[model samples]
Target: MAAVFATINNIAKPGCPTHCGINTVSYPFGIGRECSLDNSYSLTCNTSYEPPKLFPISSDDFEVYNISDSEVRVATLVSYRCYNQRGALGGIIKGFDLNLNKEYTFSVKNKFTVIGCDDYTLIGGADESYVSGGCFALCRKEQEVPNGECSGIGCCQASIPKGLRSYDLTLHTLLNHSDVLSFNECGYGFLVEEGSFKFGGAADLSTNYSEFVTRLESTVPIVLDWVIAPNKSCAIGVNICKGNSSCYDVEGGGYHCKCNNGYEGNPYLDPGCQG
Candidate 1:
């Protein structure tokens, strides 16, 4: 739903190819060009639709939410668990992974949050480095969770560290709701966008509610931050920005161009911003 824009001042730096949907590219990210560092660093802007979708390089399914000077938000699937009459879980989940590396890192600015009652969830796995955490929520009765509050009662959230490239999610139920079986029978878990979820009493366990009815329609939004490799800034002192342009270092490494303020247009190409 966020609007996408392209970089101005074509400073002739290595950049993603035009057909690869370069028009929709933004700062901190590029497509198909040496400026992208490698293939995995590029973004794919699909134009099949009206506004088009921006997909991270190497990712088959995932829509980019927003890209800032330091981070990018993406949409990913959630994991769920349900218990049948016999008290056995009726669902199975392998887990979710983001797959980031030295070239890219997940943002610590956001948190991995979950919404639901009678559920225990874990979010882990960052490049096999293995640091993880989770939260549990118990809603014995519908009235326990107050409206607009997340106090680990009916809904809870946890924070993740910065520099992680990937992660996995697993959900489990601590106790069978056979006693309150008629009221609540399922648990849900997923990484949610920061500040996007709010606690409400209405979400508590309810007999009239079923697992199918609680399933979320869309995946949660997760954010990631990327930077050029450290030791790789613009051709060391070569003044990469030729012809009256200025070079600015990207967060991690490499550099971008600007038309020396007062000026406009692609600094990398042709007419360099006329006053």
Candidate 2:
């Protein structure tokens, strides 16, 4: 990994540390109480783990993978199914429930994908009242479908809803894999950040693919859109913008700060925007 020079001055408090390894901590997001904007932004770092692990406010739900200015990516389990030659399943369905706060919204750039010779996946939200999307793929013969093509052959994909806060997924199959069970006996599905990955090769459509996936990343990267809040009032000090700085209210979560013409170094920090 290459070293990235950390810029964008103190979005958090002056004395607080701004990073957990390569991940940066900013205002509205803090490792502990001293710098956190609110309860929703508190994070925990487990030093016991070799590389150190970061957890979000929803600790039990998912593991925090990375965080950017307007987006945070988390790792979740993959929804996979393995069947015997006789088409018998030895496990239950897999997926997640995500009900995010106003600070973050799902980016519309993600796609829900399912992979297998026989796969039908449904992704929805909050008791099915709302849904992201789903896909159905049935490849009579693995050879009939080309590798890396998500054209509803061995792989399928669908668009996700914008600003979606809640999400869930379920898996279904046709012929229970009694057909096309030769090389393809199992199935896999996931939601991934668009353009980061593409469908796999012919070997990926095989019965052994389930075990192969375990050797790789189960979850994929995703984008989240965040913003500063409107109710925030810098006048009364509920929101703060330091020296030579000005605050701009946006349509999303929190107000944004910008350094004046002669300076640039994170306007939210004290002694901000030094030339």
Candidate 3:
């Protein structure tokens, strides 16, 4: 798995820690009370896990993967259905409820993906008003499945909503893997960052569920977009932009600060953009 380490200067609040293990703890997101803008942005750093682990204060199940100026990535689970030769064995229908504050939202760059010989997954958002996405993956034989392809053969993908804050998944199968048990014994579904992963075709449907799951979690993560004073534009919200910085409204109802053209620096900092 490739790790992303963002280069940031003056990103953390004064006297606060900047890094949790290998993950960055930038401003607006911190490890302690006073360190962050508010409690909803707080994180937890557990040192018991060798290199230590970082998680959002709201969701201990999701470990912090990486953080940039406008986005944060976290580890996610894969929903799966397993079957034995005779009948259904057991499986998990992974679901997540972010409970995020208004300041944050799930980015649209994620795709609802499913992989199997005869499987389809449905994703429902937290509220009925929000739209849902589904993926259906079906194949007659292992030979028909294409490698790195997710176009409704052995693998399929669907785009998630732009401002989805929470969602749960349910996996359904056409034949319960009864017809494709010889080579594929399980079906898998997940929400992953678009372009971040590619299906391995038949090799990914292996019976060795533990190894396959571990590999997927390490390589793929859910992306979230963060903003300040959500639902309020720069015209109405309190200005947080520093010198040589400009404020712009994000599409989903929030505002962000950016360093002006030809300058590079943290836009929220005192010194702002540097020449």
Candidate 4:
């Protein structure tokens, strides 16, 4: 097996800009057409921002948070619904559509979450392993909800299946906060990177809608796994590996290169590995 290290250096194409703001823009992903492996991997550096922001050339609205050899992190959307004091629908923010083509897939590291006293959320249009599912949170009183825990009391979490490329969310309320109005007036649902969220107990059930939703938007991110030659196998595709490098097939249909044993360096580059 080839040794895969996160510290592989000289990742970008020759003469291409490597740093975008605070993050390292690696190869297979680059800041421009001439640098990236292909147009699908092309990125844009927005100098309009203070430190300069990075975004996919295809999507300027989604800012790039971080990038690695195997994965990329970006800002995600939130689905929410809130009711006014009179039990009338006050606002609604639905889910979003993500189309990453064949080169990327949503990592399994994310979990679908729903937070509310009388809310239920359904997710659809994902990969086959997880085509459709829902999570529900119910509580008659604020005191019934727990702090720092998501066990379906007032907060519930569900696992998405492997190979999830895209999905949409639809939120529903059993009673529209009719019974839990005093303590809970809204419901929130989103796909978040696991271990990045913490339920704030009953206090989170407050009616201050924007603050609560904005907090999620600013802190949580969505993770996407990327691969090279996704549709071709090592035996049939053109070689991407260089000296001292070997190619291996990824489980769900893709390939990755790694440095041979007892060597170190970028496997995709010439003089691929060093002793």
Off by over 4 Å in 1: 2-23, 27-37, 47-50, 92-94, 179-183, 204-220, 230-275
What's the ranking of the predictions by TM-score, best on top? 4, 3, 2, 1
Superposed by TM-score, candidate 4 places the C-alpha of residue 47 at a distance from the truth, in angstroms, of 3.1
Candidate 4's residue-wise lDDT over 114-178, tens digit each?
99998998887655545888899999987778899999999999988778877878789887798
Candidate scoring better on TM-score of 2 and 3: 3
Query: How far off is residue 250 in model 3, in Å?
Result: 0.9
Ranking by lDDT: 4, 3, 2, 1
Best by TM-score: 4
Q: Residue-wise lDDT of candidate 1 within 118-147, one digit each (tens)?
A: 688777775555787888877776666667
Candidate 3, after superposition: displacement of residue 107 in Å? 1.7
**What would the TM-score be for candidate 2 when compared with the true structure?**
0.81
- What is the TM-score (0 to 1) of candidate 1? 0.71
Model 3 lDDT tens row, 1-275: 44467554547777888877777676667888788878877998888876777887776767788777788887767877787787476544443444566777778888888888888877877763277778889888878888888899888988877788767776788777888888888788887889888888888876477777778887788888888888699887536887888998988687888888888877776777788
Residues 1-275 of candidate 2 have per-residue lDDT tens digits of 12132344445676776777666677657788667777677887767766666677556455566665556776534677767777887464455566776666677777777888788988877732376467997788867978778888888888987657677666788877878788787778876777765677567777365464553343456566665563454444434777887776645335566777888676655676678
The whole-model lDDT of each prediction reads: 0.58, 0.68, 0.78, 0.79
Residue-level error in angstroms, candidate 4, position 256: 1.1
Please give the distance, in angstroms, between residue 208's alpha carbon in candidate 2 and its true position after superposition. Answer: 4.3
TM-score each candidate. Answer: 0.71, 0.81, 0.89, 0.89
